[model samples]
Target: MTLQTVRSDILAGTVVFLVALPLSLGIAQACGLPPFVGLLTGVVGGIVVTIFSPSRFAVSGPAAGLVTVVAGAMESLGSFSLLLSALVLAGALQLLAGFLRAGRWICLVPGSVIQGMMAAIGLLLILQQTPVALDTDGDSVTKIISPDSVLVALGALLILALWQTRFIKRSRFLGRIPGALMAVLWGSLMVLTNDYLVPGSLADLDRLSLPEIDSFSEVAAQFSHPEFSAFWRNGAVWLTAVTLALVASLETLLSQEALQKLCPQQPQPSADKELLAQGVGNMLSGCLGGLPITAVIVRSSVNVNAGARSKFSVLLHGLLLFCCGLFFETLLNTIPLASLAAILMYTGYRLAHPELFLRQWRLGAVQFIPFIVTASAIVLTGMLTGLALGMLSQLLCSTCASHRSAIQLSSYSNHFVIRFNQNLTFLHNARLRDLLAKIPDNSVVIAEYESAEYMDRDIWLTLAAFSEAAAARGIMLERWPRAEDPQLVDGGVH
Candidate 1:
């Protein structure tokens, strides 16, 4: 990359690092780990992966979607260290998948499913962070936010509104800053003012701290080693690990693809190389007592928005994290939890905003219904499950709607008119068969198929059969010349 590109990348990277910092920690906390582990993963993903990755703009780190899996793994393994072993195994699996060229299969996931996944994640973030935004102590996902949280959410919402208004858009100072970041800064000020105005009204804000990883032995003691002897005995653990790997990889591949589309200067990464980078990142992260890491869309979006032009942005982000960890720990810790909540709530709103659904609805119900169902399923259930169901529903709807071909057929007493609008395939054979059955023997039937652009083997076979039947019935079969079919109009035949 050129110096200008490098400088731009660094600027973008800084923006992404700031946005990712709190999110990584929050995800770690949500997954029942020390917040520092999340920071460690973010650093490693930014620094180490950037060196080996092919994608110029994609940012990798701990993802919120895998929080449920990590939390469950910790509970099952009975220690964070044991969970690390599984992560190592998970990394191995991803590497193996890359080598096997399985990354291409991710493209098979339907667009509806991917859209649903995004919408679900957005909703999950909203639900999880709403409590934190309100300064509530609620930890349960199902818990309702108190009135205080409602007010705080509204205040953050107002900040987002002001940031989006034309006044801020035209302002030199505010226009250059990200609206979401501004919302966080304003929300932090609001929290401090509330604390000062009414003492003890807001809960005591927790201080940030450097993750404590003093010794290798301490890391070793966090969890039991992976039980190879009981590998078959504890099938559940293996299954969970494999599931986690798949989900993480899917998210990574999708994020990389989306980033390439969003960032004009950044080309898409080689899927296999990305897999290896993530595998190495996860292995190191797990060893460092951190949560599993993957490419996150939110941070990638921030990087793109901040004018990132190359992979250096990821490296710069890692350097920032390392510097914060080594020297600016105290300053980082001073950031209030509510401020982070405000940032996340704003992110969530952008992801699943009502306008997106409304826009999808305008496209057609075929697309909109699946989008709504996917979003709802994610809101009601978890991400992966919701995606699976939404994809199935989309496939069913598509298949049911595609039962018959679009070619229209009409028949008169003496002549039969078969007007083909587009391509004909096996799907159209049934309709063609029904139309052919109504033709009378010894009648003059003009089999018109001029509008047909292409015909598959099955349709060709059907036509040949119909030609034979029409010949026996003394009916004339007339067809226009198709570039691929030179037999058309041969001596007033086919």
Candidate 2:
């Protein structure tokens, strides 16, 4: 690569590194794993997934969308090792799915449901992290914030907001600066300055706790394997694994699609390939005691907005994580949890931005209803349940929304044409028969399949029989199919 290209990749990677660090820590804590595991997932995802995936701009990591799922799985399974086994199983299933081309059907998922799911996940992040941002741990949802954290978090959010404004985006210098980096750096610097002043306050602050190492050589020793004690013996564990596989694959594909929209020039990712990459990453992560990994949109978006040019940026980001984990783990620990929470809160807000709701609302009821239903359902129930409900809503709408081409009838003088506009399936056979019977006496009826390339033998046979009874119905019947010339014989084209 050219020197300029290397510099650009380094710049983009640095921005992504700042964004990924706290998120990795927070997501791991949410999943009941140590901060180290989450960071490790990011490192592995950037390094491993980039090697397998075709998308040049997308990045992978422990996704915020899976925070609840991972946390719940660990709680139910009763062991982090058992949870790791589930992740390993999930990864294997994803690999199988990719091999089977299961991801090819992703287009069948409605965009409305996808949007709704994203909004729901965003809201979930905000709700779950609010307590952390306010610097209060509790059994109750509403806890009074610590006086010190309130300012730290607010200031961090404000800095992020200012950095993301249109003015900054249009500016030559500010545009190049990542908002996440500015927020985190400013917040960390202020905290460090205060800690320097107070001497002992740094020891009492809630910081990201990570094991320290002097060099990159120690990184290998930190890797840990999963204990597959509950495999096969517990159906629940298998079910959870299947759920993880499906969810992780879905999230990865969806995030890939979203990022492609932001950078349309990048080569589109193959869903199956994406699935394979994620599967391998998850498997490796489980082996290393990291939380399950997916192509994360937040970090990917940050990478894009920071002007990522190629997969080099992804590789560079992973390298930074690896280098940081070894040499600067202590400095990262100096970052207060409240500041990280603010960063997450802003990330959450961007995912479920109010303007997104407005844009969808303008698309009409067909879009807005599903978007609102999915978001509300997710907030009240959970992600999968909410998605199921949203899909059902869309199905009902589609069934009610009939079309003229679904079944049409035309007439010219004594010639009444029974036209199959597009689809001529068994499902429309009854309607075709009804229209055939409605042909007036002494009129010539035509069973037309000229516009439709497909039709079932069941419908064709019914037409054949009806043709024989043309005399009984006082009407003459004919069949016109593309496979043969128009036939006006004693019976149908059968």
Candidate 3:
């Protein structure tokens, strides 16, 4: 690479690393795991996943989307070790899926369901973090209201809120800095200021907890391992593994597709290869006791916005996370939990924003109902169950729409026209039969097939039966193309 490109990648890598650090820690906390495990996952995503992935701008790490799944798995499985074993199996499933070329099937999932799933996760984050932000340790209002924690959380939230405004974004230096890191700094600054001006005032505030590590060896010593025995003994482990593999792969592919839009000049990455890379990363992350990983849009967007030139930038970010864990453990622990909670709350708000709901509403009920159902189900049930419920709702909505619009019947004085506006399948057989029965005996009829792009065997059989009855009833059925198409002449019935 040229010096200029190398410089750009280096700068981008640093910016991504800055963005990834706090998110990793906060997401780990949300998953009920230690903060360092998030970093460990980030390290694996950056270094190991990047090695196998072809996309230059896509960045993978512990994601907010997986918080519900992870937390739920932890609660149900009762141990992080078992969760890690599930992740390993999930990774294996993803690897096999990639080899089977199942990535292409991701398109079969409707956009509404995906949006609902994300919105649900967003809502979950907001709900889960409220207690942490308020320092509400299941106490009364007065006891829960800690001045230091509340102020820091609000201040960090304010910074994040303002960070996206054109005024702040227009400033070159400020724009280069990530708001999450700045929020953490704001929280840290509050603690430092309190200590310097009025010590012990911030003592009661909830702060990040992490063991101090002075060296790489010391950091490695804290690593946890997966319990492989859980794979065979626990049914829940397999179910969780399937859920993780499906959700993680879907999110990764979607993020990659979005990143591709941002970097239009970049060649499209192989979806199957991306899946394989994520599988390897998750397997390694599981072995090392880290949170599950996926291609994260936030960091990937930052990498693109910061002018990442190659995958080297991704690799560099992993090294930075590893170095940070060793050298900056004390610095990280100084960040108040309230600040991280605020950051997560902000992230969640973005996902479940009013505008998203409004947009879905504007898309009509076909999209809106499924979106609402999925989000509600996720909030009420769980991730996998929510997804299943959302898909069912979507299918029902689509089927109703198709049934209503699939066939058009018009008649003028016994001259009838039957127009197929959509592809016909077995699902439409009954409706087709009913429509044909309505035709008056000895009526002249026209069957238009040009509008339909396809007609399966069931539809063809239905039409054949109608044609047989048409002749017996003294109805002359003319096979014709659509009236709008002037290129074809009508042919008599079969």
Candidate 4:
């Protein structure tokens, strides 16, 4: 709020704005929206949302991961405007989620699943952007890759290597310059110079255009307005809207966690508040014929890297977008698609590093298998379905392990004892069911846990339920807490 603070924010925002510009456009294009909408969200997200957001240093804008979903919705609705309406609905849901303090639910997602998601997204990025980086053009996703892309990818790899080299790493001046940004600049210049020396050597850069605000109706017409009658008639629309809201919320929560790691001094944003902020931003952007917005990790990292001390950095970045749109629109069009593609490819690599998976594998197969399965599902199918399958697999694996470690039960005509050797979970609840079913009415039951290391909530709840049922049966239940208890009766119980 102060002048000094304002000055620092301006500097930080400038850096982030530079980083966000290409990304916003590329993501918007990928989502099948006019690139301008991406810019609009980036500007609005920074300028407007940051004012009320809890995380002062985190930046928000169009996210690359949401591109496919947005595109599919637009295609399904047969109108971009209707998708906007869905975005508004999605935003409203997010706000409600925030108010309900449901953001904490993100923590319930297993860490392995999250790692798998990031890795999959990274792989997707490399696949999608590599072609663009090489200036390849084809109508379909498969056609995007060419020999040229392979060369360009190599160039990008070299740039990354140089950026990580000790000389650049140790130099304060050099380290401050983001290697991704530098690569884009160098690549753009190389393309431009190549064009001058040998015409048509590089792909024609005639596709870029400056967005103009001719009339409000023109912008409004771009989006396909939701038909209330149609929406009610079809359940699919509602399902899609719910899916968007849930996925967007999860991504935002993850981005917030990542942002906190990047800038620890800043207070963490309340999940609910963060949700509301993103919802409002998306709602407004969609209303104006823009794409959906979310807490993007790349821009947030850029803000932190740029020395942003507060949310004002976001505001400043938005201001820059507004000014560019208002005054220097033409200059913005000069940026080549290839340069933007390079930026995305770099971002993708960071997201889907192979080494992350290697590290997870080292932890244990229980952790690594789920992570790989989740990643594969996401790539082969879609995000939500893959995640569901992964979670199910994790549950099954856990249950099997628990079943294998279960203790045997022995019983007499009047008394019975059941023992467990390992921790218990919901997966192991069935064992209790079988044991209790066999116990005779009015029998004495000894529930032993001497070998148990831990018990999850589900197991505890099941036991509590069994205790109630046993009481009804006129059965006395005694729990042996420790292995050293006097009533060993070791015979076969050990």
> Each candidate: what lDDT?
0.70, 0.79, 0.89, 0.72
TM-score for candidate 1, please give it.
Answer: 0.75
RMSD of each: 5.9, 5.4, 4.9, 8.1
lDDT of 4 by residue, 305-338 (tens): 7767777788888888767655665555555666
Better of 1 and 2 by lDDT: 2
The TM-score leader among the candidates is 3
Task: Report residue 410 deviation for candidate 1 (angstroms).
Answer: 5.5
RMSD of 2: 5.4
lDDT of 3 at 373: 100
Q: Kindly list the per-residue Cα lDDT of model 2 for residues 365-475, writing each as its tens digit.
A: 777888888888877976667888999887765643443346678899988877776656677777777776677889887766656666667776776677667788788
Query: How far out, in Å, is residue 234 in model 4?
Result: 4.1
- What is the TM-score of candidate 3? 0.87
Best by lDDT: 3
Residue 203 error, candidate 4, Å: 6.2
Model 4 weakest 10-residue run by lDDT: 485-494
Q: Return the lDDT, model 1, position 298.
A: 73
| TM-score of each candidate structure, all chains considered together | 0.75, 0.79, 0.87, 0.76
Q: What range of 10 consecutive residues in model 3 has the weakest lDDT sum?
A: 485-494
Model 1 agreement with the true structure over 277-384: per-residue lDDT tens digits:
888877777666667888887788878778887677888888887666656555455455555566566666777778887787787766777777877886686555
lDDT of 3 at 253: 95
